[model samples]
Target: MRVVVVGGGIAGVSAAWAFAAEPDGRPRGGVSVTLVEAEATLAHHTTGRSAAQLIENYGAQALRPLTTTSLPFFHEPPEGLTDAPLLTERALLTVGTVEQDEAIERTLAEGRLANPTITEIDGDEARRRAPLLAPTDGHRYVLEPESADIDVAGLHQAFVRGFRAAGGTIATVTRLDAARANGSGWRVETTTGPIDADIVVNAAGAWGDVVATAAGVEPVGLTPLRRTAFMVRSPWDHESAGWPLVADAEHTWYLKPDGAQFLCSPADETPSAPMDAKPEELDVAIAIERINSHTTLDIRTVASSWAGLRTFSPDRSMVLGPDPDHPGFVWCVGQGGTGIQTAPGAARCCASMALGEPLDERIDPGGLTVDRFR
Candidate 1:
């Protein structure tokens, strides 16, 4: 079988890699995979623009399993595939106010499901973890110690490398403009050339529906929400790093420590389309204001800022597997904010479905199926 995987982000790369590799002890040549990307390079969009943190129990209840199943891959990537580590020590601290105490309790309970390491830290403890946080506003805290910063680029490239080593083809700078149902398969037109495939995996991020329409498949009502992130100089001139990722318990804003700098986002989720995203001035200003109010890092200037789409289904859970009405047209989009954390398991699930095999039992198929949307 020949499979054409669309979108070269983390998802596409993982699917491609899995298809070419001997997944679940499946025999090789079960499927020939070809990954296509519109951008000149893979991961130039949401996958590349992620905050790159693994926070268990961070997304919807149904989606938590994907994040859970992905931990092993992040903690221990395949051997001989990477020259550098995929994860590093980092913590995610969710702070709450007096009025939000109930919500905080609920969040803490949820965090316990996938992260037993989660613990209630005192305000002083929270402050110690993130010294810049304002002491007065700190009312409650829950620390997800298992959460860590991910090497997104390395992970993405690892997939590409594995796919190529497995004899999978990668066509960059190629855009699928149209598709026709050719019997049981599809004939997709791309900028580079036409490709024939027995299956087309629509991992097209924000352009998922467009690919669906191209293939004469029903669109899943996928909506892309715009999220903006920026980098700023650390409050201290010296390396003021080692700060745990700090955020409002309600996710109003967040700041993660970077080398000699900080990555901050307002956690905004404005709706947008499939296009090159840009940072809005007001959004950046609002993020700065929120960060300043929550912490002692009174950053007045921004070093750089950019935006990316966090696409989601109507139910807010990922829509994986083949479309009910169109089995050959697979749905791999609608990852939302948890894409990076869940990519490993999500990609494996996608690969299993594409190859007509049972899902890896290790990967819990809770909120990852298309049946929910049906």
Candidate 2:
């Protein structure tokens, strides 16, 4: 079967790779996959603009398996695919004030359900892990030492390489203007030209609903939330790169070590649509204030700033599997900030549904099924 995967983010690329993989000598043949990206380059949107984190316990319960399933790929990756390791040691620290103790405990409890490696760390220990954190920022903290920093670019490139090596085609600068159900497949018109496929995978981050509408499928309530991130030169002269990622208990702001600098985010999720995103000055200033107040690292000036959309479903969980009303029109959007970490498993799931194969044993397709959203 021929599959046309929409959106060239990590999910789209991974799906194409999975679909193009050689089948296990079964009667069914491997699929021919074509990946479409609106931009001139793939991953030029949210995938390229991520903070590059891999927190296993992050996101909703249904999505955690995607992260867990993706860990192996991040650690060892497919051979001959990437020159550099995709993941490096990094911790995640969630701090809270005394008044916010209940919230912290609740979060830790939820995290333990998916991440057994997480543990409660006292204030002093938290400070030791992230010396930049101020002593007064919070009274308690939870630490997930197993969390790692993912090489977003490397992962994205690996998928692209794997897909192409498996004979998958990628069409960049191809914006889908319309799509229609034709016989047993779809006829899609893009900037480049027309294409027909047995399945149309909707991995279009912020433009997911737009694609659905064009395909004559009922649009799901996929809301794109804008998340702003900026880089600032680390205040310390020493190698201040190994510090763990720190975030407020309320999920208000976060800062993490990025090379010799730090990447800070206000953790804001403003509703938006697919477009060339830009950082808001007010948002950046707000993040600066939050980080400066909570850390000893005097972050006065931003080295660079950018924003990306984190699309979400109404329930905030990913919408995977086939659309309930249109099985051929697969739904793979609503990843929000978990896209990079969940790409591997998400792609596998998408491929499973696309090829009519059993879902990967590593992933629990129950909660991630598109029927839930309906």
Which regions of candidate 2 deviate over 4 angstroms? 22-30
RMSD of each: 1.8, 2.1
- Steric collisions counted per model: 0, 0
Candidate 1 displacement at residue 170 in angstroms: 0.9
- TM-score, every prediction: 0.96, 0.95
| Number of residue pairs clashing in candidate 1, backbone atoms closer than 3 angstroms, sequence gap of 3 or more or interchain | 0
Residue pairs of candidate 1 with colliding backbone atoms: none
Encode model 2's per-residue lDDT on 1-374: one tens digit a residue: 88899999988887777777732211224577889899998998889899898988788787888888877777777765678988998999998888888979887998898778889988788888798988785488999889888888888898888787777899999988898888888998999999998889988999999999999988878889999999999877447788899998888999988878898999999888678899999999999888888888788788999999999888777888787777788988989889999998788777787567887686777677777756
- Give the distance in Å from residue 152's predicted Cα in candidate 2 to where it truly belongs: 0.6
Q: Rate the local accuracy (lDDT) of all candidates.
A: 0.85, 0.85
lDDT of 1 by residue, 71-114 (tens): 77777777656788899988889988898888799888888877
Query: What is candidate 2's TM-score against the reference?
Result: 0.95
- Model 1 misplaced stretches (Cα beyond 4 Å): 24-27, 237-239, 362-366
